[model samples]
Target: MIADEIREQIDAIGIERGRPLLISDADEVLFAFMAGLESYLQGEGLSFDFSSFAITGNVKDADGMALDREAVRSHLGVFFERHTEALDPVEHAAETLAELSKEAQIIVLSNIPLAQRGARARALARHGMDYPLIANEGAKGPAVRLLHDRAAAPAVFIDDIPHNHASVRDHAEDVHRLHFVADTRLARLIPQAEHCHARADTWLEARPIIERHLFGG
Candidate 1:
């Protein structure tokens, strides 16, 4: 399932020689995204409509008028531009990821835009995390596959979205998939995913599973 250009990209990164641990998702996985977004919306007298999983159609003003797609995009661009460097890490994420790095080559493969890459890296570094960060633009499946093919087996995949978990599961069944739900309220809104090997509410809950899988019980 890996393509030639992607293979070249992975080869360039040199994932083949080490045990890779892909700790990912910048928003809800590493930082408190839902709260930040809700705070942003409230300032605009807007709130999540709770009608769907996506943000574009779900964000609505107090009068219940949802922002148009372009407006939503514009708002997001502004939001990330200002707050990318200020986002707080998910409680316990830095320490957990730090501990895991002792045994595996940890890299963050995120869907964050290229424009925000440096700020995101700075944000993570400020939180005591200093790992390689890959800012991707499309469905994460292709990147995950590229990593899987070029790296050693038994890779670990962590993301806040179920679809992402499914994407990795479909692409590389051997890769360990963890569903990390950060915002308790929105977490409750998302149903349990059968494809995800584990569902984690906090980095603490995910720590042992990762350690056990990597270090062996």
Candidate 2:
């Protein structure tokens, strides 16, 4: 769902015609979210199993027992507070986006607490991806739809989550969906989402696909 602050950010932007739009996720798509989160979890005597795409069921303690959602949620809160500003960008993510942004309206639409929005934005900017970062909560369809409505040209949505790909399909079916997972471990665990037009595990592979779709050869 789109938050009020996110709506304000959208209302402030203008998408020029013929310019393609790239709406992307921050964690695991542009930034190394799982990598950072795993290290942070380790600091707290917890570790991620990477058994599945979802987080709540995969984080385990030193004893190898998965923690409940509530506990994991609390740990996540701390993790973001400690590491949001320090997450390493996925290799080639920034340079690719920087190149694309010259010809497209690129937006980082991430599902994160509003408190971490500024930090994430700054982190991306430091790596040369200084686009508008919108903070979202659940099913990113509505927010993607609003952003899509503002564009009169080709649009592409990228994320590591399958449900998000499906959500975008439900709301903005015309937008090209690209499923991207930066971490090889998580990438291996996730199957190709049916709604995604294509999948890329690295930005090197992603750039050409995005380029071909956003601007016809």
Candidate 3:
């Protein structure tokens, strides 16, 4: 179960008034996570075993033995502590989010450790793309539900995780779900989704779909 403190913090950051066109997700969706994580691990004498899809126990050192789940989690905590501020946004992400904010109430819904939210938001703001960022924990369905309640209708959820996308599909039947995989390597691994309204690898490619669905362009 997610802690009340974190949920309250997330709720405080969500879009509260009027119908919203919420566009969110932080790692991989907005800022690169896999690449940054890999680099951080390498600096710590650890590394990803392949370019394949997996994290935690799947990652390993050069010898090919898995890093074990606890070590992986510890590494991630340290990495976020040191490097969350260094995350670089995907190309055109700032402009796209800013533009979308003008047309609709843009709120960022992200499932990251609560400790990293402040640094993440500050980093995003430093890049000129700050918006209301939620530091959600666990499955995103409940968080999406909260957004749905606030926005009423015309909510659009964008994320890179298949599970998170599925969560939204289950909770918000009317919301438009966009599966956005910005990393070239991970994009290929994202399975085809019948529930997804659109699958995009770049903001440039997705702008048309977002404009059409959100604004009837």
TM-score of every candidate relative to the true structure:
0.88, 0.95, 0.91
lDDT to native, each model:
0.77, 0.88, 0.78
lDDT of 2 at 164: 92
Q: Candidate 1 residues 1-217, lDDT tens each? A: 5445444545656664557556567788888987887777787677887666678888887788888999898888888887788777889988888777877777787777678888998988899988777776655677787777766655778888888878877777788888888888778778766788888888888888777666664
- Give the Å error, residue 52, model 1: 4.2
At residue 109, candidate 2 shows an lDDT of 91
Q: Per-candidate RMSD vs. true structure?
A: 2.4, 1.3, 2.0
Candidate 2 colliding pairs? none
Per-residue C-alpha lDDT of model 2 across residues 65-131, encoded as one tens digit per residue = 9999999999989989879999998999888888888788898999999998889989988988888
Task: Tell me, by TM-score, which candidate is best.
Answer: 2
- What's model 3's TM-score? 0.91
lDDT of 3 by residue, 1-217 (tens): 4467656865676455665576578887789888898789888777686555568666787788888889888888898899999988888998888887777887777777788889988988988777878887776777777677767657788888778778778877777888888788877765645677888879998887787777878
Q: Which candidate is the best by lDDT?
A: 2
Worst 10 residues of 3 by lDDT: 11-20
Q: Model 1's lDDT to the true fold?
A: 0.77
Candidate with the larger lDDT of 1 and 2: 2
Model 1: ten consecutive residues of lowest lDDT: 1-10
